[model samples]
Target: MIDQVRALFAKNTFLPCDVSTIADDADLYDAGLSSFGSVQLMLAIEETFDIELPETLLTRRTFASLENIAEALSGLVSKAA
Candidate 1:
């Protein structure tokens, strides 16, 4: 899931630095992820994972870092199962 999310970030986000080099828990916003980039990433994640994130989960906190994104996706995937 992390790898998938990482790949999605690489393809979808506007981060200035290499997504792979960012720490899993690092703040993506500080690394150059804009609000629009996060939205694009959210869409990409939904399409890739085949899960829709709840409205409540669509927040900066959920998309704050690679680890957070994976964690949010994990919960959504489990619930979908």
Candidate 2:
């Protein structure tokens, strides 16, 4: 999942930092994730995971970092299952 997210970021050329440097718990916003980038990331995540993100999950806390995103996705997947 992390690899998929990283690939999306790379495909979009969003972040300037090394994708490998991004820890799962690190804050993507603080690490230079722009609003536009977040939108793109959201779209990529939705497409990659084949899940419609809930409105409630569309918050800074949820997408703050890779870990948060993974956690959010896991929750959604679990619920759907």
Which candidate gets the maximum lDDT versus the true structure?
1
Q: Each prediction's Cα lDDT score?
A: 0.86, 0.79
Query: After aligning candidate 1 to the native by TM-score, how far in Å is the CA of 4 from where it should be?
Result: 1.4
Residues 1-81, candidate 1: write the lDDT tens digits.
788788887776468789989999999999999999888888887888888889999999998998999998988888888
Lowest summed-lDDT stretch of 10 residues in model 1? 8-17
Q: Name the runs in model 1 displaced over 4 angstroms.
A: none
TM-score of candidate 2 on Cα atoms, chains taken together: 0.82
lDDT of 1 at 55: 98
